[model samples]
Target: MDTPTQHSERDRSSEPDTGPGERSRSSRTRARIASALSWRRVLGGAVAATVALLLFSSYVVQPFLIPSRSMEPTLRVGDRVLVNKLAYRFGAEPKRGDVVVFDGTGSFVREDLDANPLTGLVHGAAASLGLAEPADTDFVKRVVGVGGDRVVCCDARGRLSVNDVTVDEPYLYPGDTASRAPFDIVVPAGALWMMGDHRSRSRDSRDHLGSPGGGMVPVERVTGRVDWLGWPPARAGSLEGTGAFGGVRTPGGAHG
Candidate 1:
């Protein structure tokens, strides 16, 4: 029989030899597998984050980029406002003096729609990030009169009045009169009369008084209430109503 030590050496040599080249290839393969796994994990995390952001923006709150100078003194162009999606939900309704974001589909725009789906998607994504203006039909203005209220522009004192109660609008842009255009209309039930702080530059209820819907934005079209200014870190804060309508009575002569 072969010596014990000799037998052990022979057994070691009998095993498949793993050369430096083979070892190097094995290491590279392991490294590639590890890198792929790391990349998959990273991709999964990114996808999850995007889904969460979309859901939150769709249901909870959305950042709205101010598109024009319509709401200027109070909300400037390039400013982003935080819209509370559930503000008018359930039994609640938008009150006078509240800034709101609504789709002006039938009231302001006439069947306006994005022609290209890809462009729409890109714009929508950018809008959600507050980097681009919202859809063309989207409007942001303050609620000047709610349902069942008689809104008149340019009273004897050159001030707007709601239900005959002259509103004190301290929020109006400097030197901008309440309204140069005279209008007298009773807001229909389940509708709102919206106007911008920068009345002179804004084309609001007064502009569409003769059109269908009579410049009335339906309550259902209101997407949310603007509750906060979220852009320009130095100017970020809650956008509380100025209580311009505090003295005004609700519909049917009810005081609140």
Candidate 2:
């Protein structure tokens, strides 16, 4: 019972057998680490993508939804337009006949008493993605006069005149007059006179003549130019600025 080979085999069997248990614990640890890393990568990627999109929308370009029929025949309700934020970022300025979007707080609206900061932020984000209505003070219209230009409605031929030059607005809505309200105002320096194509239904510069800023929108208030209509698939196209104001003369005797 005490033979040398028998004693060696008994000692080998007495030692703890831990190979399988150790291996199982090591495998589980590795799997948990891998799963954690994968989730972190996915979350980081999503956050980065969201930041990039917001930056692009704020600086390079922005999406705007048509809120009303003010610019009908040119833009329709529910249509989405891409505004070029950099259009006026350089030394260039907004010109006549250019369709522009601007903040009309001091010019078009006396005050926005219903604005809520939290709600505005949420609505603004949704609007930037073309999923909701734009801000209450945001407006889109066509430029009729810019900087020291005299704009008059219903000239001898019942057509709007800029700097005494009659403008042939072929973009006006069907059956809409040039302007039912008579107005004669000289645009101040660094200001713009905007109007909607549907003159009858639009309450534009002509409607706010007695309000503050004389219904003239400051150039600094302009957000961007509506460069393209991006929604409704069938109505998508570039919004080309017309040469209708080409013949109009500025105060300095140069063409506007």
Candidate 3:
């Protein structure tokens, strides 16, 4: 009984009424998801960058804080220094006059043998601080002898000698004796004899002579060479080896 035009109108009116409302809802949901994903991606990239920087700083170059006056006039308390992690790489060993950092794991830092995990972490962090007692474990010293060199302290003139030549260490602190304790020893093969610039306050190779390794630091234990003093603007400078060593030759070898 309906007219043909009326029937057509009814059919058109029955079509689904999902207009802009449904589309807007869907678009909003999609936008929220995209924003979340973008933020996650950014955070992930930041974390990755942080990890890379830590790795490079830990293994390739390390920042060291001067904890004491042991290396004064060259390095000061609170000073931060950049150590070269690759100085002794590729068949090369530490050389005299080069300032170095080494691990005293067994040399001076005795293990608790029963410390809790937390305690161990604290100790490790303290060592990293580089500013406390027995600093023996985290030492920064100058290389006085390297493998087979005869190193003796205090000649008649109160000077230190290496391989029979009196090394004129102009870096020695004013009014400080080269060494107060008398020492005469032949550096073992693959080991080094080290000392500090501030010889008076530094307890270095001299203090470990009677210990387990005879105070000779193993070449493998050295972390790297202290190349730059980085903190305290007035004291910032490079820790260079005296070309005074250019004339000194390795034992039993022709001078290069």
Candidate 4:
């Protein structure tokens, strides 16, 4: 037997307690989503991702764009190659027939870069993204001779020979002679003699024979070895090196 006022009071007392704290909890849950989408948080995430990508591109693997026909029949213009930075990072050496990328500033280009710091940074960032051209001094070529090897162009059969052994190059472009420009030289220790598949069109170590470095690329300056073709969906495959030196003797006179 309760009065109307007493019943109303009990109803009010039994009502769910939706106070400021409950409201605050709901507001916090809603804010969590906004916080995740906040400009500052999103910007931080993007910056972290960019840094990781740059680091990976710098020291792990990098995509190099081919802008010339120097390696035609194998790599074409607009083809992108994945350069494996770890290929020679350890005690492993660059073997004959391996394709490699190196900085050619002093050896091939014969000019030092007086680059502005800001411009260099911007160019690096763009190059890492594959949006800008690699440095004008970057070069990709095949290893015709390694350290302590004698490289001679044009034997009796007009073929290039390494370590005094005639090399049968099957990867040379059609109708292209091993080399029309004759040369006889020994690769100094810790250096490499590079040539392009399209020797006729490429300005490789042969073109800088008389330069200060004797057209020799220092092993220390090698950036990485080209491992695979990355772009042009139809051309994706593991790139095989010119295996002409399998029968050639090593620098120690031991056949490898």
| Highest-scoring model, TM-score | 1
Q: Estimate the TM-score of every prediction.
A: 0.93, 0.86, 0.78, 0.84
For residue 226, model 3's alpha carbon misses the true position, in angstroms, by 1.5
Q: Please state the error at residue 51 of candidate 1 in Å.
A: 0.8
10 residues in a row with least lDDT, candidate 4: 108-117
Per-residue lDDT for 31 in model 2?
100
Q: Name the runs in model 1 displaced over 4 angstroms.
A: none
Top candidate when judged by lDDT against the true structure: 2
lDDT of 2: 0.90
Q: Which ranges of candidate 3 are over 4 A from the true structure?
A: 1-35, 115-136, 233-237
Candidate 1 accuracy as lDDT? 0.88
Pairs with backbone N, CA or C atoms under 3 Å apart (clashes), candidate 3:
none
Query: Could you give the candidate ranking by TM-score, starting with the highest?
Result: 1, 2, 4, 3
In lDDT terms, how accurate is model 4? Answer: 0.87
Query: For residues 91-112, what per-residue lDDT tens digits would candidate 2 score against the true structure?
Result: 7899998999999989998776
- Residue by residue across 182-204, what tens digits does model 3's lDDT show? 99999899888888889998888
- lDDT on C-alpha atoms for all candidate structures: 0.88, 0.90, 0.78, 0.87
* TM-score preference between candidates 1 and 4, better one: 1
